[model samples]
Target: MVLPNLNWRAFIRSQPINIMSRSFAAIFAGYLVAATGSGLLALIIPLPASQSVLIAMMLSFSFYVAAAIWAFSVGTSRQAWRDLLLISAILYIFILWVS
Candidate 1:
């Protein structure tokens, strides 16, 4: 019986850092952006605060799902991070400006 040898180093080396970074951003940072943006939107919308919060809570998951999809769909990890950060920053700035 012949046993196949696994080259762990080669496998590790084959994985790109950008992909890992992107995955991290998708899983963690993306969620943060979505949640923050949703909360900010909830605050800024014309609806009553209570209603807005309720709606925002309901819709936050959708934003997270969409962000995850976008993170993976982009051409590169850097682009994904950049887009997510840019969007988050813009939303945050808008929130600050509105308040």
Candidate 2:
């Protein structure tokens, strides 16, 4: 049996943006959303501080994963960046209002 070799060079060449740039955007946006959401949740929830923090930490991972997925799923690099920025801005505004 023969195993197929992955061609990273070809994959990179075919993408609208370089893989590194895409990955960096995804990771950065994901973390920003996660952190902002966690902080907002911690402040707004009625539970004790420790429990709220714990719950925020647990739920933040899902936000991060979802943001990362959205970043990569968009049609173009520009759209991905724009969408992330827009979402982050909205979240920031909500956080400000809640605090």
TM-score winner: 2
Candidate whose lDDT is highest = 2
Error of model 2, residue 96, in angstroms: 1.1
Candidate 1 residues lying further than 4 Å off, grouped into runs, are 1-13, 16-18
Deviating ranges (above 4 Å) for candidate 2 = 1-16
Q: What lDDT, from 0 to 1, does candidate 2 have?
A: 0.82
TM-score of 2: 0.78
lDDT of 2 by residue, 1-99 (tens): 996897877776575545555677689977888888888888888999999999999999999899888877887666777887788788889999987
lDDT for model 1 comes to: 0.81
Q: Per-prediction TM-score, please?
A: 0.77, 0.78
